[model samples]
Target: MNEQQRTILAIASRVMSYPSESSAEEREHIDEAVDENIESADIRKHLRAALAPLDALSTRDIQEIYVSTFDLKSKTGMYLTAHEFGDSPKRGAAMIKLQKIINEAGFERTEGELTDYIPMLFEFMAVSPEDAHHERLQRRLANVGQRMLNHLEEENPYYPFFTLVMTKVFPNPTDEEVARLERDREEADLEELPYPIMYQ
Candidate 1:
């Protein structure tokens, strides 16, 4: 990725993560970066619209929204693999491979977060030394990302930010790939057990 793309991904990763007291200052820095480097009018406009409401909210409010939106809602969970694999062994295996890829690129997941967390994916792509695998990973996660967008309310502050990631950062996944995820979702729904068990 180019410098502008990297900057945008880094900003998105931070913005999408749980908010902190420093979030306001970090947002200000993001705005300055956008003004200085982001030349595309469409990207600039969409990014600003995405960040505007987030900027207005206090850190605590944003934290509440983040938790309620992602943590509380199973359908809107931030772990991309969860949407596809639920608690299945497939999910664990996929995460292990993802962690290996991230580690190979000199990036590591934050404590208590899964390897396939959406923001971590963005953060990894932003600074990963190897560009060869970025597009491959983006395409792989595009379906899960789209499912997340589908679950989120259109007016949610993070909606447009995700739209930007899906449309701009990740290349469009093939129709077959999308259909496969749909089938997986259906199968997982049919296989839902009465109670949660290890490895699903």
Candidate 2:
């Protein structure tokens, strides 16, 4: 990792480790990690922007957000795959009957893979002892796992953007055009915003 990536990771570590009931000193530490040293605002910005038109896909899309934001590149022979949930994100319980479908499959999990994020896991334990077993938290770990895998190769802090597909910045020109126009209107502070979104 470069200086800035390291700095941003430090910020991420702080954010991930932030207490729900954080103290003044803890808040100050987080602010210092992000405002004073970290340059990852754009990274967070791009991620929020990317999720806007994604239809808020549950497991995979959310995991994609972290993976892309943190630039987790897969290694050869080490595949990260998920059960295909094309258009919906849902939750049901109370011995819900199986619908001939699994909700989502986890990424490649192995002994070696654990090393990529064990420290982060430890840090997270310090922060959210409750979330240690939450399903959402568990799914997001796939992203963190990918981050650990690629942390060594992430030479440029912003290069992680390549993994994203913001509807506005995505390949389709129409989407890009729409995003650009929306940006212009927002910049102008127009009273009636067409896109109606507050871009990150």
* Candidate 1 lDDT over residue span 3-26, tens digit each: 678778888788888888988788
Predicted structure with the largest lDDT when compared to the true one: 1
The weakest ten consecutive residues by lDDT in model 2 span 77-86
The residue pairs found clashing in candidate 2 are none
CA deviation > 4 Å runs, candidate 1 = 130-132, 185-200
Q: Give the lDDT of residue 172 in candidate 1.
A: 71
lDDT of 2 at 133: 50
CA lDDT, candidate 1, residue 128: 79
